[model samples]
Target: MKTKFTAILLLQLLLISCSGTISTLKKEYSFNTSSSLKSNWNFNPKEWALEKDTLTGTGGPMHWGVIESRKQLPENYEINFRVNMTKESLFEVMLNLDKEKYIRTYLYQINQNIVIGDGVYDKKDDSYGKRGGKSLFTKPMELQNNKWYSVKIRVQNNQLYFSVDNKITLECSLEKSNLSQKGKLGFITNGETKITDLTIKTL
Candidate 1:
């Protein structure tokens, strides 16, 4: 009888934990009018423009258009969006960005940007990093040019959650980092990358 009671209690706790995660997610903000992205979000090169619904970031060194909002983001949050890469092998997102310090804060709740690129699983070192990089996938996992991929991210305290196309790939904790500063969310695009349907939500 005692063992049965313990099993029932454990089952109830599991259900409650699952339900709590399901209930905490809520949408916060979404963007429109990328054509006027310049007036809204901060970007360099002045060479880039919001043509229709997407911000077309051109390639090259200084031309690697960096797009980040001046608005400081909340402590724990989720960001979801779609990215279409064109002929480029890489792109990056920024989290807990300290523009003043030119670096990222110790990720509060997995505080790092979602970086999806060609494979490099074992090529990491102690300083292994992207947007304070957390993980890398295989070359086959690389984003295909001209194809749109859904990227979703959830950050809470010291853990970072990442998913692509509804497929959850990474959940990492920041061990070397400890700074929890709040800053703007941003991205730096290499090659031709277009961003659309960006939504930010609080947890």
Candidate 2:
């Protein structure tokens, strides 16, 4: 009877340990209200606005607008959002953004191409430079202005998986990218763009 009780206790402990490995952190944003957007994000009011369940950013020649989340993300996570281009523009999703490390994945609406790159920050001048950028797909995907597209990105074990509208998918290794284990997520637009239905899940 003593041995049987000990085995049962051991099994319970094992179950608890397994459950602890799974994470339950999640965040969702609908962009339905200005108050929620102000509380959870940082952006320039002159360039971005929240209205009608959408966050819109207007850009022009030599002008790029950015909005960043206040919360930092976990190492292994998934992000989902929808984007609509008002015109031909450059839309970028930035992850693991810190003072020195970041990863940027962007789509050029003019060319219908997707690219991923590492960010370079200049501490002396407080500006960013370009580095280590590559195209994800060899063929350009069809893109149109004034149309909404669903975007999903998953990061796990130093690997990144990206997909758009469930039609095009790409994966890349980040093991040697020197990115931060955890950091903020942000979006950048070089022309008019609207974003909504942002969700994040950590594993």
Candidate 3:
């Protein structure tokens, strides 16, 4: 009986230790200059700039590109940013980037059509593998071009939360074992985009 009691106590202690780091730590960010923005990112297609505290990028032949953080992110945290567009475009937040695989949370719009959704994707051998991609699980919201939208994302414990304009709009489980606890955080865009106020904080 004493041995069994001791085993249970050890299990409890393990659970507590795990939960200790689940309490997130915050990251601070402020837009000041072009160097500050460049210092925090790694981008492809190599045609992007930060001017007047706004970041703009456009240089991919396929009209698509990715800009990733220089540092990896913690497992559980909140990230927020504001974006604007001059024309129809696709914008995405790529998180938990474990090698060539990651989770994509996107807000896509084209000539008055819009979608707010997410998917799991892998890029290997010049091909894309998508599994359980619920790319449109909600209604399309009418968004004005050249107008900024406040977007927020949070991952805590076993769930992912999404919000726009300060309203929570979606939730999904983070159940994939391959999804790493530490990975790159970044944004994907097609053609032209202007982003500002990128901030992240731990849960």
Candidate 4:
């Protein structure tokens, strides 16, 4: 009777420990820069800059150094953000897998079209695997220029779900990519754009 009781107690302790570990692994994002309108980030002339916006405070000219999350993120999690397109052009928020290079997955846009694409670097060929990569998903919805639109993305395992303005747009599953690396999350803009209320929650 004592042996059985001890075994049960041990099992309970193990379960509790695992639960605690999981709770710790799921973490909230610490925004590196919070902007109102005319906001400026780490002014690296070589990689990033800020452009003026007549409607908004300032448009971010993000290139390589304007990353938000340097901390490791949960593999399977949800990410959402509010982006204000002050100027009409192509933009993206990227989750990258390369430490030395910018190989990553991107949520893309050009005028009103939205797309999700991935880029990889090849080792054997010693070149970037896919130039613009392939579109995993696309949406016909048009984004209004100079308006704020809420974007939501859920990535769990190999599946991805994308939504705009609280409406489901596309869903896709990816064949496991060989290049696996924990990466930083950031925004990408070609002409001019502003981002705010960026929030990420773990599943």
Assess each prediction's global lDDT (C-alpha) against the native.
Answer: 0.53, 0.70, 0.61, 0.50
| Most accurate candidate by TM-score | 2
Ranking by lDDT: 2, 3, 1, 4
TM-score of each: 0.61, 0.76, 0.69, 0.59
Error of 4 at 86 (Å): 0.6
Q: Which stretches of candidate 2 lie over 4 Å from their true place?
A: 1-32, 121-139
Task: Output the worst ten-in-a-row residue range by lDDT, candidate 4.
Answer: 52-61
- Number of clashes in model 1? 14
lDDT of 3 by residue, 7-117 (tens): 999997565333312112332332455565566667653656677656776633244556666666776788777888655566677777656556666666653333334
Q: Give a tens-digit lDDT track for model 2, residues 1-203.
A: 99999999999756533331212244343244677677777788887898765789876645567777777778789877789988656888878888656687777767777666675432233233442234443336787789999999899998888888888876778766555556777787777999876666676
Q: Model 4 over residues 1-203: C-alpha lDDT tens digits? A: 99999999999756534321212234334333224211322223343433332112222333222333345556676776667756645556556445433323343445355776665433223234432355555667666667777888777776667677887476666445333334655555545566555556667
Better structure of 1 and 4 per TM-score: 1
Q: Per-residue alpha-carbon lDDT of model 1 for 149-185, expressed as tens digits?
A: 7878777775666677775365555433343346667
Score residue 172 of candidate 4 by CA lDDT: 62
User: What are the clashing pairs of model 3?
Assistant: none
- Report the lDDT of model 1 for residue 5: 100
